[model samples]
Target: MSNAKRALQTEDLTKIEVFSDPQLSPDGNFYSYVSTKANDKDDYNSQLFVQSLNGDTPVQWTFGDVKNSNLRYSPDGKKAVFQSTRSGLPQLWLLPTEGGEARQLTTFKNGASNPTWSKDGKFIFFHASLDKDDDIQNQKEASKEERQKEQEDKKKQPLIVNRLKYKSDSSGFHDNKRVQLISLNLESNTFTQLTNNDADHGFQDVSPDGKQVLFAANLNENADYELSNDLFLLDLQSKEYKKLTDGNGGYHSASFSPSGDKVVSFGDEYEYAGATLTEIYVFDLASGERTCLSKSWDMQLGDLMIGDTRMGQSETGPVWSKDESSLFFIATDYGATGLYKVSLNKELTTLYKEDNHVFGFSYDQDKEAFVLGISSATNPCDFYYLKNDGTLTKLTKSNDAFLNEVAIAEPETLSVKAEDGKEIQGWLLKPYGFTEGKKYPFVLEIHGGPHAMYGQTFFFEMQLLAAKGYVVLYTNPRGSHGYGQEFVDACRSDYGGGDYKDLMTAVDYVLENYSFIDEDRLGVTGGSYGGFMTNWIVGHTNRFKAAVTQRSISNWLSFYGVSDIGFFFNKWEHGLNLLDDPAKLWEISPLRYAENVETPLLILHGELDFRCPVEQGEQLFITLKHLRKEVEFVRFPGANHELSRSGKPAMRQERLNHICRWFEEYL
Candidate 1:
């Protein structure tokens, strides 16, 4: 029997376990988190696990092959509440922390989520989708027969959407149901519908006194044409709300101060629309005064590190200190996400600024420490206890067993000077089990979000490619977050201009510096914005032997009309609308240059992707075929824009294999 470390394979994705959503108890004795792993059934199993700070082993609190997340402990720490799909749809479930079996709390038709306990822990506030005249107390899950009949009825009716934001990439086509806030009384066993308006209300927090709820919503009559998501404070007794924001931009992730006299929130004025950097603000309740705390900061707020292995949500906060003197938050900067603190006196301090990703965290006021979810190039994710003096203590080695079995690739960080003398950050993964003086095929990976960043995080796809004996290169070019605001917004209105040069320059730099890379046998791939760039790259240059574009945009003209976000995203990103400047859109469309494409391109798209839409790939494939160019199209059934990241486990494996096969055949 051989006992050697094995390279990570595509199928190993199912074996990788992900940890996130860490919540330290009020007393700081125990913490709860969600651990997710892909199963053999082509689905993911996410459950809650609790561990005490006194070195107790993590206890699995929830069971079954169901998704159980959003764990919140009661104020007394005797019981905990979480959202689970064990009983069909996702609804609130309560379990005693000391002992006993779990009990379902809400039976809403649409399923309740975003559960938060009130200060006294007597009620649970959450949000659910409801129609205008629907009953809030309609807490019965429809039977299988009724659900089937409703689906049939829905198929017979035509969707009449009057608003521009009628559909989303995550939720698909919009219906009459609008997300509304609801509260469940644990003692009385009663449910109360808080806000009954046409607009969707996002539950943020409940006041310390339990008399008010802070939420985000645009109650304006013309919200259909607006992009503002203002914050509002609602009085539980009066059922009336007071607008806290000026309604000029978007605001969210708000929370009350410990004293309950002020509110801290994260927002932006939409100065550059989607490219705006988030700023923190503090609102004085009595005087109605607002102060921008992060006005001088130029980076984006929250975790902007793009990775596929991350699952479940973590609180990105301007979490108030116990004494209400300062707040702590996470910010994206220079290819890394770090924990920072800002005092009320305008003093800023870096708590933990390592060259890694702090994906999620929870602060413990009692110990004045933090439980951080950290990930590096070699680690998927592990929870750690970080002190105020910059000390770190490992809390969980969730992936230690997998790490021991698999040989992971460690990315080497590289910074290249762009053609314009700007610095572009990137990482290179050498071929697994590489030998000296050997030339390896190179694959350049581009990231989507043209606004998101490629940082020091565990990416299974890149590792799989490295295992397949290909040198993988990924970069955070212009228009990627983590850099300053100017760098991130540089790609707007110049999709294939500066951003394209940045990528090409990075490739040139890598080829010139790395003697082990075979420049002649180069390949490129990306999704979403990266997908668009992949198409653009093939059309403009034939330097690569093979290319793979997933959920890409081939024609900007069609993309402006068919995409769920096409209507407004085009104007915000391209600085042109389909109605006024059709010529400019046509000039940027990759479909127009299909005749010039010499590289063998592979197009992968999700059939249900509304973000880029399947038509984009179809157009590219048809044009390449008409031009007698080498091209192949593969579509995943029931997949969306996130097919490469969080799509079906089986489909993700197939997509990965197709990518590897294409490069193998051409490169």
Candidate 2:
């Protein structure tokens, strides 16, 4: 076998590292991405690397023993701004475009990050939590009698914030009101506050004209409503802010149109029932009217924000052409995500379509070309540019060295009639070097979001499993996105019912049609909702010999009390408040069916994961041990729910290793 094939066949999970966060330079002359390297002690050292569009060797931009991420080019493309923890805390730093000594932009008692430059490049905007005493120390000290009187008034008027879902992924619930938007003047080397209210104003996007800032803020009247976030426009000149949209629903991650005539943002229009469906809305500043863009296109916009990170959803907000008459965006309606162009007349045209994933588009008007980040089941993401005449050019080949040695598996799309007579679409990856009429063990991999879909991208964990001689089957099931609203919402309040049957039907079809799949030696695994389903599946049936659940929710009651999103999910998924129906929550929990599980199971969790805490894994492990069922538990320290996608490189490698080890032992 060739060396590339041999490297793909190797089972040593640590031999390879994953690359992500691909950022295109403003001028489209270069591309940058984060490369994570792991050491023998499982310590992850990440750095930034930049490569030119001419496909030259990538130049390492950041040299560090610490984590450096969020590499972004300045508006004029003269500097690169990024966040680094080399000083023990993540701080914003600026590096010269031509390469020079990096200068720290902000020095606060706490960390500062997410730096964005203004359109004219006169000022740099970022978010930070300055020490509270600094804001008050400037006030002239009055007499002791006056100070005592002011202190008494301060005690009477305490900071009050009313908002739901305040807790974020990395930052826990914060009531002290620390996050705010601040701007740094490049000429004077001074810092000034742009937003200083009690509410947390996350920096979303700056207007094309640099006169206004768009952000997501919770300035609602109700503190417990799980409504959508409203978009607000902060006028930089007037120093005044006004609400852009009203009612129950909210908006997030807005971007100005090329002409600055309209604003586009992504979020759901909430109903009394719950969040109806997420879509892209374009608000015209002149007419003061909002129009849903994705409504006519029959696609749901997921994670429409400006960033290089591959999380939440792969799709970004609309990318306008130079003339501003057409927009380009990524959609997965055609079975795979591809670059699509939408004209201002509401006409849609496909620019590129393939089974692989195409996302992150940056259009260059002068060159009349666009650069996009592309990947597939066997290919990791790399920068690619498309000419006006449809010619394609690869800008960087970051993974070619590693992929040359790996025996990668290609996914074959399959269509099967579900048990309910509805057509279901999925992909199957056969084991490497497969032969006809030979039965092999199979794994039914499930995706999280229950609302999220599995695309034709390179999944490291799935590829590793296929390399280990197992046919991997993954489908969008009912609750997955890419389909219409009805299909995505099909699993609401009906978990482990229709979605479970859909997966089982997929397994049945694979076993009957694919002669290479072993029926009796099957396995199941997933995380989050998928993890919940794995727990639910093992309890209901003994068809599988082994199962693994990662960041799962075993008990709904405990999850409701501990999870950061539990309060919102409990009502949306189950339509029951914790106080309204605690018993009902327990009834739907996977732990209630623990007595029926016969499959040897493995539980994986992250220590710092508040979304699905490690306690859930602990509960399941202890229960299975007491019941004398074969089970093992693994916990990753300092990791979050996004372990597979954006967690520490070393921990992510360990996660994949543990999963393969468990399956190799029993399957």
lDDT of each: 0.91, 0.75
Tens-digit lDDT track of model 2 for 1-667: 2223752432344444445566678877877777765546656667888888787888998876787887778878889888887765677888998969888776554567778888888888888765443552122224447657865886788546454565656775545646788887889887778887655678877888889888777765563454556788899888898788875676775778877888777666664234255666778888899877566665655431111124322225576676777767666653567777777667778787777777566667667676667777777667777888999988777667777766778888988777777667788988876777778899999888776678777777777788777899988888777776777777888888889999999999988888878788889999998899999999999999999999998999988868888887888888887889889898889999998999999999998888988899999999989999999999988888887767765677678778878889888
Clashes of 2: 10
In model 2, which regions exceed 4 Å deviation?
Answer: 1-4, 7-28, 39-41, 131-168, 173-177, 221-227, 271-276, 303-315
In model 2, state the lDDT of residue 464.
75
* Candidate 1 all-Cα RMSD: 1.6
Clashing pairs in 2: 4-404, 4-405, 7-405, 8-405, 8-406, 8-407, 228-250, 229-250, 229-251, 230-250
Q: Positional deviation of 491 in candidate 2, in angstroms?
A: 0.7
RMSD of 2: 6.0
Residue-level lDDT tens digits of model 1 in 73-140: 99999999999999878889999888999999888787889999999999999999888887876568
